[model samples]
Target: MDERTRADVERAEAALVEHYPHLVRLAHLVLPPSMGRHRKVLTAHGLVQRALPWRAARRAAGALPAQRGPDTAAGYDLVRQRTLELALAYEDRRRPAVLLPTVPFVWGLRLFPRAGGADELALDQALSAVPAAVRAALGLWQLEGLEPEAARAVLARAGVADPDAALRAAGQLDRRTGAGAAALLAAGEFDPCTVHVRPTDLLRRRQRARAAAALAAVLAAGAVVAALPGGQPAARPAPTAAQQALDPGRLLRTPNEEWVRTSRVDFTAWPPRGRQAGDRRLLGRALRVWAAPPPGTRIVAAAGTSTRPPAEPPRLLYAGLIDNVMVVVFHDGERLVRYAEPEGATPTLHFARTDNADLATAGALVIGRGNGWQRYLIAPWVAGVAVRDLLAPDAPPHGLHLAPDGVTDRIPLPPAGGGPCGHWPATELRTSARLESHPAVLVTDLGDLAPVHLAYAAAPAGPAAPGEANGAPALHSWARTACTLRSLRGTGVRSVSNWVYARQPLPEGGGTAEWVCNRAETWRGPGRAMVQFEPPAAGPADPGRIAGRATGTAVCGPYGRGVLGGVRWQAESGTWYLLAAGGGRVDGIDVTGGVRAGADAPTLAVPAARDAPAEVTGRLPDGGTVRALQP
Candidate 1:
């Protein structure tokens, strides 16, 4: 029996249903433009519907994949490959065709996708001029974010005669400089989920309508003469207009005064402040799309957040044009919703749950994100914004400009800890309550929908005493672990605080080193801690390796500061020793396994084997033992 998992009919069905619009779009783009707009639209939808494998077909196919191979057959991927193959076959004149119109064809209606801008038209024309295989490769690259190599592989599996040559041909076309292929594909011209309907042959339709009406009148007159059994309809009152299920006008609006009285400085406190906030039509569209999103709509939701529609009309947090794109934000008590539609591009919406939120977590939101920079919708309380490089602690922060709508300029990001992170960039936001200025906090984007709070605090001083983070010791502590943050990149983190938990003197005349614990709190209600032992490094810029990390344990917080970490060290005299340290929660340290050692105090240093593996634990003042966290 084949051990490799094969695509089953059930999973394929779900994928086809979920991604029907996207699959249809791919088929439509791959099909020839020679088929004309209406024919292509119908045929694309038909091909995608037919891509699903029946149970019998799946059983017959056995262990074989739908063409992209068994190694990577995400149900959607399987159907996608199958759809492309069918489209390619349908376009080929030699093969017998399978015509399917899942949606009944309306003879009097002409359907076409909404037209896009000049760039989209040019892109469509260029794509249409290429071979079907080439168009498929380009669509995969532009829409699916597949690289050329991956696109080539997918094409080869879909039975392309020469994928490399097809890609080369498509590459030769002039995609305007600075115009991204993915962004161009997002234009309205390509989406078939929603189409423009026009009456076909208007003159002929009018003639036919008149004939049908005459026939219907005669039939009704004959029926009335034969029956005479109808009772007088009771005096009826005129019907009132229906309150739309989610009326944009009926949406909950919080009074501006609510912000002043309420302690909650979250989305609920935000008053409608934008030039186009009163635009009913734009708001209605946003609300409608949120309640029942079309299959073509692109949605991004954070981890652990439910995408269920609001039970009641969501509160209008903000409605305005930001950086030329129309954006609308809604607060549904627990979650935050954002809708955006760039000019000439298809609409996209994203949201995240912000339950149990506070001022710091709700400080800034990512209104728009791009390759290297991201624009944030800063909270109203933020009086000033500045950019600071955490690596350069002594350097003054530069001003960050915000638009009238509270959307900021494209703030460039420092390189995520992919390599040697020589510089760490963060935002210093000055937030004030009603009247007085408050100490600023540094925040950074960690691939979350919102920027998370970043700060460093030393244990003896406690978590960054107001203005203390800008001081030398606090900045030094943060600088050591700032680059190490790359490991937590892309997590749905809401806030991260780094603090020195303990200070210990090393053995064999080695200098005193700081034991720090960095804790990160995520929007999903979980926290992670990274413990590091920063020995007397060559320079202040050095970020020491992680000593240990733990989840669900408050190893370095105000409540439970118990943490034990051990590392091998070599003195200037070339003698090796195992150095162990613990925070204030523990009174004793014990090292076991490959190295055997114990200390009466919170610090331990003993001569041991070079490059040894040891288990370290701590004994609290009350005699309770705590195991050390691991790497």
Candidate 2:
């Protein structure tokens, strides 16, 4: 080989050495974190060892004498073999324990193939003969290198003919194995021995092959039966008696069997037809009512209000469970929405509206332990919503929102102060205030507002008007008082505010509830200017007091329709706080409070206040100003 090639191989070897630790770290991250230190170390060592052979082989090839053609080829072959062996070993070691059951099938594929040629038919036969589950796993592993391709190639060499087929099968296997491993890891199972493949154990291999063959035969038979003539195609069996009893469609249907047969109504049909008002009441009574309004069920009119049709029944969209969390989706006709379980001492519903119409704004509501609920109006850009424990009486609540600008807002709702209702102040606010479309609002007491401050209030621009712009028919205040604001030190800011923005149709006809801003801004010091509007004392429903407190500074700025920003504020108490806000008013707060500044303290400079009412500019970490709001 030429000197140039020699140098290239040397550089690659050097890079491999440098990045060895990082590659191992990546592998560990994708694998189980709960792995024993010994296992992790062994895995890391094994991976590096495997990588070293490849690097050395490449280097050796490069150093081969230019005139020695046969010697060079032989050296290259040796390098390739060593690289493949190491990679295969590493891949085998990394196969998640949970996916070990499929190893035999994957191995079997290597031992068996259809027609032995480069023809597509042969490839098809080889793939077809493999068990579907095993095929899927191998395809993911070999082709994808959730396991190394070299390892997959080794695995596939048993039966696969086409190199491409081998690679693909390996990838499929790796993907399945990795996914199962991930699931197992998530469940806290990390013992590699539990899932490891004993390739050297001939007896174990034979046993596994027998079991796999049996399973494959049974599955094949089932498939054949499904394809047989006169056999009815498998259909989604009708809901069981218990399921039918609870199913919305079944419950909402008329009692007549003929009608049920002829109509074949499903849950998709809204506003159950042919039911009397009495029937509606009976159905409502039978259904389990949530503490809060069901998700997606819009508040067409408040509980006690004078509106058209006299009484508008609450409409539910979809209700189900996701990851042990109860989720509901419903509509008031104009909006498609969803809501999930609440976070904190307060039961909360994270909601989202998915539609382009003015009514398509999402929001959230936090129900206090005492059954009091607060609404938070989110931004239009928030596609879906979730709340983790961050800002609560105890645990913190983390919220995630997908902003319109392609950025995801990960907001941690940590307690405002060390304790509930402590002097955690706000350092900023989004200066441009616009109506939010969603049905939730954030409230904090420290900045430019009172204790128990309320932000993102979507009150009717006026008493419910008759046009589309009047906003929803009733002056529905999204649940507020759940979001707590913490203070920023020395900035004189009381608290920062972030919220989602969306426009909803007014209760009347002609206008829209325009979303003004969903942003993150800071307050400078403890002043009345930092106070926010607080709710009543009897807890929301009862009219009481709107009190304010002198917490700290208030920083307020705006994020236009599609922008997101983060702010890190250090308090005089030696605490550090990081706040991030994006287009949908999704705010993430981290209480590094009490963290000390180093000699090279990070600087935060506020931007000059804008003169234009339609524009907003905020300071960034780099001492530069970014225009976050626009007309």
Candidate 3:
């Protein structure tokens, strides 16, 4: 090499060494705290060393004019950009492929703790919850002092189309936190210094794999190495069932035992001649039956950047459990739509696009849980179109006026029972179908476990007799029993309100009246609940006059929709009545499972491959008329 070139390289190397500590600190802020400090430092070192502009300056020596003469500011911005890129890649690779379907709707500043009160743990969860591109955009603009357009360019490099929107959202999130990004670095109640640093060979992992492969090849080729005396390796033992169960990769694919046969609904039967275009019941049933897998299968859902051309690669449109069935829908680029019923192992064609406009631009609607998630073709054309025209195959599609502020097609669904089906209230649909589209599947621990009946034998010598006027004591005993049951079943109890003074609705023409005691709780997996006291005799309902062991549990399904059943004590009537109210909003008519008049009701089963729905008998202690549920 020429003397001038060699000198330039040396100068660049010296500058890099001097700036190394600052670069590492910058990387630490941009990357997840889950990655240990050692790796962060190493990754930062590498990024700085590889920055193209910096590298060019080093190699070309006197080719580029010096900025600020030997100041670290020279090419520092370029180094920061490169560091941001590396940090983004690092975060993307670490994110789990499967995500809870509720994330998009639940997305808000609540996911992040206030930056002023932030610690490593809160920051980690917040970062994991948000899109990596959004996080990177925030890092570039806020931490690296890059301009909005410059940050957008960096985001564009990472395949984010609407960088401005992403940045705006990030800014809003930051503002909502009422704290700057530095809050994540601030020491709070928890000491950041004491954090356990796990050693990782991230940069060398690939090299290690390659070396292992080469060694295996050598050993297969009959190569042997001399070993010192007593240097023999210890024998490794096989993994036990428990160890296998704990393996993180084990649930990537559904277990064979978890597969169940699914029921099918013919497509031709839907949209009855007089049915409205947006019938909520039809929409719910159609999506549920179309997208749901067999009763027992758990769903495995994933979404990310895709290279499939012409239109964007398909993304997860919906993932949820409808009536305990796993349903998943895809926002696909492919013009052909397909459905797979339990009886059919392979998906058959459902809809084929023949319109001049691209169907890829508009997103799809979804209903159901887990493997039962079904997608609704809300918009078949890029331009906005009316629902009736979009659904009619013979009608020419009309142009839709796309909203300017990110909100696109507003496809309204028919309100069944006075409410939209499946509790999905979002009407403003936006397009996130490109490679940047992030799709997620919701998988709960309660696959399809039918809600188990939890009962407590009346405790002796409590504040009041089990059948006495004081209901709090008996309800309290039942609640403890329920808590124990919850613990044994291994389900998480998100929240519980016990024995609070709330009104319980009496059967028949009774108006709302205050109750002496009530209990409720939100649960994870399959069921959530609300507990109320019921009076035995019908007529003017009186909470104060209510007697006997008359407590009923309103069990909710995965998405806060569920059935109201269990024993209702009516002291006045002295006769037991079996009651079952449909699952879903009490105000809405879209009932999932309900019992009217003495008719037989279906058990609440979580669609499980092997577990059948738990049988339940909603027997009330004598008297009072049973309420009929509206479909």
Candidate 4:
């Protein structure tokens, strides 16, 4: 039976390899060009990954025989449909301001490359003008060959209000774009007949690189390690008597157990500089777009230095807000700098080379707050530090103490005291991580901290869930678990600057909220540690009650996994209420509420119950009588 299961898995894996690129192309066609091709590929891959579980579940339920392989076509269709749904939801929040032309389809075009020719450029321009929803409809119907009814279903799933209008707009877009190409397409005279590079071609390229690296590691395993990306680390001068007493590693630590810091960096040091009156105007616009300015407070711009502007123009820094955190983007000629700041706090900077030839290669590093501490997400090239003492802030600083088990010589990370920049340290380097290639280097001038060089040669890709090989905790798994424990929802990987602005629905109200996620983290104060752990406050003066019928079902699986499934709800109470499910000692409600309702709520818990539906209830703040019927 085990052998059969392994064979079945292999079959499923083979199917995935065959269908992955088509899935990616389908995703790209439907999603906005601005989302970038890397994002499209990731979305496509994630959708396909999600489908694998469902496919496996069906096989377990005997929907398919163990000997029979899963249907690749059906799976790909499901993946495409999901991508469309996600695209539609994404489009709702970030509607394109203008329509753009659909670009020329080529087999080997660079991922995320801008349109090159007149035809492709015109297509992008035309498509940009169309509403995102409409563009999605066109991609679904024309490109994916979805029936109108199926297109409507996709739109409906995405909560699009006017699917018909979207379809009409798709037709309108074709008419307005180049008449010759449009006519050819309409006449079915033009077909992009070329097959893209096969998935095996990519696999072979990666395999050859890996084989070469393995051979090199075997040949030079005992040699002196090469310099990190930042070059050879500088020698540290003798520490002062007072400085030597303090551990550099402890600097980034929470003072008195504070999860976050209060001190703000003085942005005035390199005061924002504007070149022209128009630059000042643009700066104001950027501030308005990225920051929530106080009603009447005027914003000003300044320069980083007094020197006149150089002939080679500095890149305009893009700005946006993510979960109230400010994101500032600027590209030096060589590298991209993404700076993030909490409200009124100094910024933390992450810099990476802008020279990624392959979109699949890691070109970006993300530093954002997670679970009351800073979290770093480096691309495959950047390695996490295995330090025994202080190094730098941006290289996996949060879970420093939780290094993978068996790491006896782990290096301690640099102090998190000052923000990402400033003060102390000549050069810090870590030469070992089970997964790292070269050393990870943090090169700084003795005192100046404004722009420290964080450089490390590219590292090989390791298991996404680290420490799973042994019994130790996994970094990626723990990060996700910690985020979920703090009620951070929909935590998943993303592509782009690795930064994306998105909307999350409020758990209580029916209302939705626009926020940022990919490469961003909302800084919630210290987690369970900050809670007072006191009993509920005395009842409010105005009493309230919630009484309703809650007909929900339950199912229990093996291994003590009980689920409250097929649950549906309707609210009898006129007022909003906090709802939860309880049975035995199991707790399914949070302090805020089990599940809050704007006017109604649903069963959102899997409270353990033996062979029965869990008892679900609703309550008001004043300790009012709340009852529910559970059949």
Candidate 5:
């Protein structure tokens, strides 16, 4: 290789190493938790390095390859193509808001997507698109590696008329510099390594430190250029610390003032949660039932009349609360589910889940809620139940009382043989309850109901059963188990799920049970959302126990506004498990003492026994018969 080529390679390597960390940090800021697959970043980085030949450094003492491997060359080409595609797509998406109107620059980008491969003609075209000011800035930063001021001088030679304006536009000025940097990073212009260290996102991160420091130095030295006619300093608002912290790549300050943290736990390292055949059967049944209906549809009602024919008929899945009015969700798993609503006095039908209402044939019945239990035909082939009077927009508040053991309601039905319709009652059954207010009942695996304030709690054994002993105070059983597994098996891991709850009024009027997973942890005084936990302390039995005072806070739920319920962390032999309980309840298997990993997803199981009420007996706020149901 020629000396020039070797020199170029050295420079590129230095740049890559120096800037790789920043690039990763930048990526971390932009992508969400769900998209943080490390392999993807590594692949992109490797591709970029190969595309820029200057970046590749040959081994100092190795023989040159006789010929490039077809596979290796093909891989490099593929990576380059993918990188260019992504960059172009990002540019296209942001083009409308990119203020600068440099068509020539855009044209260059369109022609030579990769910078290293561009020929003289392409470089000239690309350079033409860039304003002289931009060219100078690039030359200083990329070629000469000069400081900002020196770069300004180089830019002046390039015929940049307003050096300050150009720098400001490129995001090198006070306050707005952070915003400009973020924009450039998102545009894939900034070195990614340096950008990702800060918390939050690229959009939210401000170059506050750099901006503030530079501004302070400039002000102290009395460095002043031509001022406006009024001689007043430019009317630029100073950026606040909060604004600087607004990084889109990092966790924002949650309403509860918590920061979201991410950690990975291997699934295989954990002890297996034993699986039962009965559990599998239950899960299969639930999946089958749920899978039967298409999205946008719901099972309304089901019935089995005693006086009906002895033949076993398919169960009804949807119903309404008015005579001849019902809505049914389709069972075909392909089409969106539709809701049928009744019109006014003239028995009309309304079909939901469709954009083209005119295309709908005869409308379905509009099920109107009455003061008492009313009957309506849910669907042509199904039956269901709904609360009456509660359907009104401003109806008086009421609670849904689901019987632990199902109940049946009777309704009058038309004679099967076309005889006169008669007043008959039909029975409908449910196993869950909904409330309008915060109920006094406390549902937890831990049996304590001492009005103790708690920010979060975790139960390794799924939803705690009715008779589990409340562990002793200060004895961190969860932590101890984690330690034991880790000591005995080198690959053990632990996880915890945190739940938050608040003592507040319910939405409607009666009572309500809400759930949420803490995506972030925050600390606010009582009545504000927060997470309270004891830090780890040295101990003989288990040294990893997190020790601190029990605390609680008012927190916002990931979906709706609700108090944080519980947080569960499980440590296994392989990886740690953290389950943040939010809206839905989840189940898991227990393998030996270590909880099974990969059990984060809710497991569909057969419904609990019909006679068994899935209730968590605890203190009731009103001292009344508070009926509890599984969410």
Candidate 6:
């Protein structure tokens, strides 16, 4: 073989056939997940298949990566190099690699790599956090059994700018993970060869097919029309462009009386109410910069939100000086885009999807946040505003000065998260139409388009029932639950609801204690919930610790009418008691493991050894069983 020539065509094909599974697995591991699961699987296969020697160019080779295993043919190395290069290119940010198989789609029934254990999940998540180059290097080193230098050389050949730094980062990841990269990789997590098959939604599949056919017909007609005459398409500004090319005059405007006239009370009905609402220059700059932000501008979109230009001419929500910075909000049916420009500072833009949002979740927007204080652009129907600390239930809510523009004065926010529970303050909005004021609704910011509505369930209400935050018990119930919100910061949460499922009479006359579930729902589909057991205390601030917490669960959501939670409590005499309680839906309770006990009622109290592990199971009225929430 010529030193310059990478590999012979016949030899390369043979080598690829012999090691097809390994190559596909490596490609799958290297490809970024931004393309989504099905696309990633298909793209990985396509990359391997297209890596034939005669068809693909040789990867840059100052020095070839070290060969491992029994077969060390240069043909294997050639295909491997090409596959790595293509896989790196397939990652987000660089360019498209159109090596998709042209034959029948393999994923007509949604195909995905087989699910792995916890270690594999952690490894996959860790890989997702790093650059594609780093992930490639790690995959080569661990899955391919290559030396560190060999992996670095391969990464450099594949056009990774800083291969040495990538190798170093890969090393750091290996150390940080709970298990070794090699051990985790051996779990078949990145194996595209072995996969799980699930059918796509049949109805959605049919709808998509019709939609695609219609789109193709439209495109064909458009092409024919464009070729015949002066049928130039309209020029739309590129969203990520660094220059302000979009005309600001195209921005949409609405009358101030639109709120009263429109039947909708959400963002659509929000009228322009800022002092700078009529400032054409400021509004123009804002719109232009949003379409084409400058180099220094910072852009952030919440999870599950789109990173695209406005689908429609965005209607003005509010435009004014908020906390000394000019802030502008726009709603275009899908999302709420906010643009803020501080004096002598580069502009900052934010986007959050408001899909499926009702008036309760979209009532208020946090326009400005800084210095432990936040300013809100409230709904026009909101006649007055007040601030109250959830932890301080006895304290009266102090009225906040609401400007005619519907922007509230800078109000102090809740205490910072990740600390011991303290004051949890919230904005209280009052509607003007109702003379007998409705129960005060407390809304708190969780870094989204709208503040998350806080719901609480007090006594006399069922486990599934929730009410507004006005009573003393509701405040105390929330105080125990508010500390968990700190974990939800920047998670694009839509709402945080608390429902008291059951009250258990503590063993040895420890008095009545409440069990509540605080669940945080996010716009990104998945949500987390925590069940806490609150002991009877003299004051509202006496917090209860978390009994159980879980992710990807609807333990306290609409569907989960029943919730079971347990706490190992020590009575005044220092005897340990396993106390468990369930909502109304639970007909009986069962205690397993060290403390074996059963209760005909919803509540269970059993004497148990100190620090003994036990599982609490609840039997529902309908004969369905429910386990206690787990971390």
Return the top candidate by TM-score: 1
Candidates ranked, most accurate by TM-score first = 1, 6, 3, 4, 2, 5
> Which tens-of-lDDT digit does each residue in 1-631 have in candidate 4?
1123433455555655676555444445555443434334344445445433233332365455555555556445544555555555445555444222223323323223232343444455556456668777776766667888888887776667899998888877766555433332322111112222222234434555796998697546434333345444345457554332232221111122111122221111111111221233333332332222222122221112111111222343334443455554443333344445444322344433333212122222232333222322222222333321121222333323321211112221232322332212222233224332433433221111121222111001111111111111112111111211112121211111110111223333434322111111111111110000011113111111112112111111011111111223222333322333321112232222333232222223222222333334433334432333322
lDDT of 1 by residue, 1-631 (tens): 2222334565677788877888888888888765557767877888888777654343344455544333324678878988988888755556566555565355766778998875676577667556788888877877777888888888988889899988877666535413666777777788877899976646545655886998798678766765767634335444333224368877778786575577877777777767778999999888877766543355678767776666777788788876667888888887888888754334677877687777667778877765457788887788888887778776788998888778888887656534458788788778866724456767887766667787667656654332225567767777777887776766667778877777888776678988887888777767788888898877777888787898866556556657777777788888888877777577898888888888888888898888777888899888799877787
TM-score of each: 0.64, 0.21, 0.32, 0.28, 0.19, 0.60
lDDT of 5 by residue, 1-631 (tens): 2223344444444554544443333322222111122222332344344434433445457655334322343333223232333322222333333122122121111111112221322233233233334433443353334577865664454344676676654443212222233333334332333222212222212344576788897785443533435455545677554433222222111121011121211111111111211232322322233323221122332111011111211112233222333332221111122233322111211212211211011012122322223232221111223231201212222333322111123322211222222211212211112212221221111101001111234333222211111223212322222221111111111112333221212222323222322222211112222223222334422322221112232223333222222223222232322322222222221111232222222211121222332222112224322111121
Candidate 1 error regions (>4 Å):
1-245, 414-417, 433-437, 461-469, 558-561
List per-candidate RMSD values in Å.
Answer: 15.2, 23.6, 20.2, 28.4, 31.3, 12.0
Residue 203, candidate 3: C-alpha displacement in angstroms = 25
Per-residue CA lDDT of model 6 for 163-219, tens digit only, reads 999889989999977668888776766788888887654654565679699879878
Q: After superposition, which runs of candidate 3 have C-alpha atoms over 4 Å from their true positions?
A: 1-22, 25-70, 89-126, 146-163, 185-195, 198-631
Please give, for residues 1-631, the per-residue lDDT of candidate 2 as tens digits. Answer: 2233443444445555554443333333232212223333344345444443333223364455434221333333233333333333332433333211112122321111122222322232233334332333342342224455554454354233354655555345334332343332222122222233223335534655796998798678778888898775555556445334333444332232222233322222333221122343333322323222322222222112121110123345333323333444333333232334321111122222222222211222121111111123232222444442211223233455433322233232333323344222111112112323333323332211111223342222211111111122111222222232333312222223322222323222323323222122332112221212222223221211111222221213221222323233333444443322222222221112233221121111222212212222333344544333211
For model 5, give the 10-residue run with minimal summed lDDT.
Answer: 442-451
How accurate locally, in lDDT, is each candidate? 0.74, 0.30, 0.34, 0.33, 0.27, 0.76
Off by over 4 Å in 4: 1-19, 37-55, 58-76, 89-116, 179-631
Give the CA lDDT, 0 to 100, for residue 232 in model 5: 51
Worst 10 residues of 2 by lDDT: 365-374
How big is the RMSD of model 5?
31.3
What is the per-residue lDDT of model 3 for residues 555-620, given as tens digits with 9 covering 90 to 100? 322232223333333323343333233322232211123332332332121121122222233322
| Pick by TM-score: 1 or 6, better one | 1
Pairwise TM-score winner, candidates 1 and 5: 1
